[model samples]
Structure formats: C-alpha cells, structure tokens
Target: MLQSLTGVEKHNIEKKQAKALFESTLWSDAQTIGVTISRGFEWDTKHIIESGWEQGKQMVVPKCNPEEKSMQFYRLNDFQQLETVYFGLQEPKPSATEAVSPDQIDLLLVPGLLFNTNGYRLGFGGGYYDRFLANFKGNTIMVASQQQKCESIPVEAFDRPVQYVLTEEGMKQSK
Candidate 1:
C-alpha cells in the first residue's frame, strides 16, 4: 500500500509526519538521534536528518554488517559521508564517519512496514534492528502512516517494542 501512494500524497503525508516528530518532546530533548537513510518506497527521512542538523543535534545512521546481521551507527555530518551498499541501501561510510555507541544515542527512529498499537513492528527480515534494540536503553520511536497501522501483528520473543509512534496526525504512546 505504501508503494502505491501517489507521489504528491506521499510527500504530503511524509511532511506532516515529519513535522509532528519535530514537535515531539522526544525530538527536542534528544541530543543524538539514530535514523536510517530511507529508500524510495519508505517514508522520506532526509528532511528529518536535515532538521536534526539544523537543530544542532547529532545525527547518526547505521551501517549494517550483513555477515553478522548486526549494525553500527555512525555520526553523519554530511550526505557525502554515505555510500550505497547491498540493495542500494545508503549506509554511513565508516572511514568518513565516527562510530557512535548505542548508549550514546538519545533517540532511535525505528523503521518498519507495519506497526500495531502495542508498538510491535513487522520489520524487514534481516532482524538487524531487533538485535540492535536488544541492548539499546534510549528512547525508541517509529514514524508511520495511518495506512501502515494494523490491529495486530505476529510477535516473536526477541521483538522489542518501540515506545512511541508518530504519524501524520500526531504522536501516540504505544501500549
């Protein structure tokens, strides 16, 4: 359903969602943020990254190690610090960006295809975020559209729920 959205509609929804996130206390209080460089079909995150920079917040992005199925976040100062990797996913260049420890992040923007009221998400199969979330103690949130909301989704023992969900309408604390 996300992929079928018209370009204009998608842009509008993304803008509204981003604005809501920007107004959030979580965003305001956070000094360091962790986010992914969004893909074509995903909700645009470029604006959020730029907004973080404009606010003088430290923005970090993940670089996945496919072999270990793990990810490490790196501080991103410029778009030039990213390089395309498998499946055209943009990842931080370790050589150009400094690694940031998980505990150092003040907020983490979790990504998913669908989310339930409980905050559990149906993430991409890799389980990279799942592993990362296992030990992460900071605030975690996901930006999603109403269309991506579901009544329920299958949950596994290892799944970690986000604390909040931000949509075009506003932010909601997950059950």
Candidate 2:
C-alpha cells in the first residue's frame, strides 16, 4: 500500500508523521539517531535526515553486509555519499565514516512494511534490524501508517519489539 501512494498522499501523510516525530521528546533528546535510507515505496526519511542535520544531531544510516547477514551503521554526512546496494536500496558508502557501535545510538528508527500493535513488524525478510536490535539498548521506534498497524502478526522468538510506533495520527506505545 505504501508503494502505491499518490504524490499528494505521500506528501500529506509523511509531512504529518515526520512532524510528529520531530516534535517528539525522543527525537529532541536523542543525540545520535539510527535510521534507514528510504527506498522505493518506503516512508520518506528525507524530512527526518534534514531535520536532524538542522538540529545538529548525529544521523546514522545502515549498511547491510549480505555475506554475514548483519548491518552496521555509519554517520551520514551527505545523501550524495550513499550508493545503491542489495535490493536496490541505498546504503552509506564504505568510506563515509567509521561505524558507530549500536550502544552509542540514542534512538533508532526501524523500517518495516507493516507494524502490529504488539510492535512486531513485517520487514523485508533480511532480518538485519532484528539482529541489530537484539543487542541494542537504545530506544527503538517505527513510523508506520494507520493501515500498516494490525491486531496481530506472525512473530518468531527472535523477533524484537520496538518501544514506540509513530503514525500520521499519533504515537502508540508498545504493550
């Protein structure tokens, strides 16, 4: 549904959601933020990136290591430094900067196709975020549309739940 969004729909929804995120206490208090590069029909993260830059907050973007099936985050200085990687998703270039340990992140914005009330998400099947969140101690959140929130979803034991889910309407704390 996200990929099929019209220009107006994308603009209006993302604007509202990003505004809520930027105004949230989590976003304000966080010094180092971990987020993904928006690809295809995913939620537009440009607003968040630009806002972070203006706030002088450190923004980190993930670089997936397909061989190890893991992800590492590096500081994002400019969008021009990103290169398309696996699955046509943009990732931080290897020479961007040194990796920031997961524990150093203040807040993490996870990406997903859908997020349930329980905080379980249907991701792109890469398990990158799931693996990273396993040992991450920072606050985790996902920005989703109302239609993406379901009553329940199939979750495995290894699946990790985020602390919050922000939508166009408002934020929902995980149960």
Candidate 3:
C-alpha cells in the first residue's frame, strides 16, 4: 500500500506523522534517538533526524553487517557522514562517525512494512531489528501512515512488539 502513494500524498502524511511525534512526550524527553535513513517507499525520516539536531538531541543511525546479521549504531552529526550501501540504503560511514552504545539511546524508531494495533510488525525480513530488540532496553516506537496499518500480522516467537506506533492520525500505545 505504501508503494501506491503519490509523492505529494506521502509527503503530506509523513509531515503529519512527524508533527504528531514531535508533540509526544517520548520525543520531548528523549535525549538520544536511533533511527534509520528512510528509503523511497518508506516514511521519510530526514526531517526527524534534522529536528533532533535542532533540538540538541543526539541522533544515531545504524550500519548493518550482513554476514553477522547484526547492526551497530553510530552518531550522525551530518548527512555527509553517510554512504550508500547495499540495496541503496544510507548507512553511517564507520570511518566518519562515532559508535554509540545501545544503552545510550533513549528511544529507537523501528521500521516496518506493516503493523497492527498490537505493535507487532512485518519488517523487511532481515531480522536485524528483531535481533537488536532482543537485548535493547530503551523505548521502541514505529512510525507509519494510516495506510500501513493492518488488522494483524504473522507473529513469531522472536517477534517483539514496539511500545508505541505513531501515524498521521496520532500516536497510540500498542496493545
């Protein structure tokens, strides 16, 4: 459904979702945030990254190691610190950025293709986020458009539910 959105429609929805997130206490209270640089079909996170910088909050992006099926986050001070990697994903250049411990992140913005009200998500199938969440102690949240919401998703033993889901309509604590 996300792929069907026109550029204008996606942009407007993304802006609204971002605005809702900004108004949430989670956004206001988090000092350090972890997020991914979005791809074309995903909700754009560039604004969120910039807003974190403008608010004096530390922003971090992940670099995935395909071999280990793991991810490490790095502090991203500027977009110039990123390099295009596999599948055209923008990842933090290890040489240009400082590594940030998972414990230091107050909130993590989880990515998903689809989600239910319960917070269970249908991720991109890499399981990187699932593995990372296994030990992560910080708050987890997912931002999606209303179109991305579904009645349910297939859950596995390893699946982890996010604490909250923010959409263009508003933010809701997952059941």
Candidate 4:
C-alpha cells in the first residue's frame, strides 16, 4: 500500500494519464456529472471540467463545510462564474449549490487517500463523504494515481462502494 501524500509533480502526471483514460471512455456518452475540487493533497480533477466542456455536458462541483460535515453540489455551467469559497475550493453561486437528490446525478468522480479495485477506500479520517454517499444516487467512480491503490483498505460498515476505479493504468471496475 502506498502511504504518505504523492508529490505534486508525480500527482499531476498520473492525474493527466488517468484523465486521458476517463476522457476516452466515458466523456463521449456522459451528459451530466459531478466532480470535486482538487484541494491540497487531493487528486486533481480540473480535467473533468475540460472533459465536460468537450462533451458539452453539464459539470458540477461540491462545496463542503467541514464544520457542518455537509456538502452542496453545483453545476459548472460556466467556469468564469465560479467564485472561490472555503478552503480555496471553487463553488457555484449560492443558488447553484443544491442538495444532491439520490440518483439525480449520472456520475460522481471521487478522490480518496487509498483504495482497492473492490471499491473499498480510506479517506482522510473524515466521515463526511462516507455519510454523504449513503443517499447519493449515481455511479460513483474513484480517480487516483496508480500509487494510491492498496492491497486492502479497511471497510467500515458505513462506507460507500464505488462503481469503478480510474488510474493512470486504465479503468478497473470494483469487484
């Protein structure tokens, strides 16, 4: 299992490679999706926005309040319209961020500290996403560098499973 954070240079390279795979496979048919901001130490997701743009699909991002342990997702209809919010992550207008109704989204690209092909993941010791995903109705996919893959990740009872895992190597569905 890979531990510690990946360096910026290596992370960027892996992110680019994984993004390329994501673009070639799903971008062509996906019409709507949600991605998360690449906070420090998190996987980069700017390419999801670019891929969404190329496909003319609607892209959404999440605004999270660690204090409240809650999240609001917004459609990235226009990048210029986004404004920086808490923790330097971009969020749509107040009205743009809305509660995610189950299954309302077609896809959700997730980022995590560690994961395995079976969909098990270890987050940053926070239950925020694990809880938020309890009700999400969509195909959750994990995007991370090859180095993030682990032989096994502790599975809590409340953990949510992903539909697939995307890495620099290619795509692998959770088994």
Q: TM-score for each prediction?
A: 0.98, 0.96, 0.97, 0.79
Lowest lDDT block of 10, candidate 4: 96-105
Stretches off by above 4 angstroms in model 4 are 1-12, 15-20, 23-25, 65-68, 95-102
Superposed on all Cα atoms, model 3 deviates from the true structure by an RMSD in Å of 0.8
The TM-score, computed over Cα atoms with residue i paired to residue i, of candidate 1 is: 0.98
Residue by residue across 39-82, what tens digits does model 2's lDDT show? 66888887789889999999999999989989999998888889
lDDT (tens digit, per residue) of candidate 1 on 1-175:
9999999999999889988898889999999999999998998888899999999999999999999999999999999999999999999999999999999999999999999999999998899999999999999999899889997689999999999999888999998
Candidate 1 clashes between residue pairs 3 or more apart in a chain or in different chains: none
lDDT of 4 at 165: 83
Steric clashes per prediction? 0, 0, 0, 1
lDDT of 3 by residue, 5-117 (tens): 99999989988898899999999999999999998888899999999999999999999999999999999999999999989999999999999999999999999989998
Ranking by TM-score: 1, 3, 2, 4
Q: Name the regions of candidate 2 deviating beyond 4 angstroms.
A: none
- Please tell me which model should have the higher TM-score, number 2 or number 4: 2
Quantify all predictions' global Cα lDDT against the true fold: 0.94, 0.89, 0.94, 0.72
Per-residue CA lDDT of model 4 for 82-122, tens digit only, reads: 77875576766766444555356677887788888788788
